[model samples]
Target: MVNIGSLVGAGGPNRGQASYATSKVAIASITTVMAMELADHDIRCNVIHPGAIDTPILAAFADESEDESSERTIDGVGLQIDT
Candidate 1:
């Protein structure tokens, strides 16, 4: 199983979520084993986690300007389009 989730890199530079990171890590490990075990049953288990979308919470951090805030939020807007 491949998880795109990231508790480590998602909580910004200030917040250090150790518990959240540990949980995600445990979840990832469980997912990996489950996927391997369930593969014989024709079950394709996978997970997708999209980080830092253009949401209101993210907007608060980016209060300078839409263009300015969007740079850090969505990998820089001019270089990429935020989905």
Candidate 2:
């Protein structure tokens, strides 16, 4: 199984999100364990901690200037798993 988490998993900037941070950290640990246990069966597991992504939800909270900027876009690394 693959897990998607936030950059907070890497200790990035965060405020009042101890629970959120803890959960993401747990996901990383679980992914590691799954990868090791499934290796013999040709099964794979991974975790992706994406950086700031300017999605519609984020846009909703963005300032008017940011929302209006045509150049505004999501800047983050994406995960690609080859099975």
Candidate 3:
């Protein structure tokens, strides 16, 4: 099983996103429990925590144009993951 979470879940609470972060945290926790419970059945469970990407969701929280916001967000941070 695959679950989608966010960097927010791991980073803890943000200024105005308590609910969103909590939901992501739930997904991660569920994934972990599922992994352990399903291991005996040979089922693998995983959760992905992706950083802020260029999307309309990001635009919703931006103070500038969507394109500019996305560019700034993507260019300003370096989030690397090893797969």
Candidate 4:
């Protein structure tokens, strides 16, 4: 099984880093190339992207105060990564 969509947003800290984006994009590109190369062998490739599932980063945002917790998210935890 393949996870092409998984490639989506693998590029975190989206600050226009060529290498970072290039690396993540590689996940998708490689999947495509592999899929094509193996197609003739009767193989198939697919991708899944579980966007925003419960992760450690998001867990850090949890708090006793529901209101405050609501204001926080994984990416914005700590020093407010997002504006």
RMSD values, in order shown: 6.1, 8.7, 6.9, 8.0
How close to the true structure is residue 83 of candidate 1, measured as C-alpha lDDT?
Answer: 35
**Residues 5-82, candidate 2, lDDT per residue (tens digit)?**
777776543444579889888888888999999999999998998776646645543433243331233222342222
Which digits, one per residue and each the tens of the lDDT, describe model 3 over residues 2-70? Answer: 898987776565555779988999998999999999999999999988777656655555534346644
> Which regions in candidate 3 have their CA more than 4 angstroms from the true location?
64-83
Ranking by lDDT: 3, 2, 1, 4
- TM-score (C-alpha, index-matched) for candidate 2: 0.60
Score every model by TM-score: 0.50, 0.60, 0.70, 0.48
Clashing pairs in 1: none
| CA lDDT of every candidate | 0.55, 0.63, 0.71, 0.52
Q: How high is the lDDT of residue 22 in model 3?
A: 86
> Which ten-residue region of model 2 has the weakest summed lDDT?
74-83
| Strongest candidate by lDDT | 3
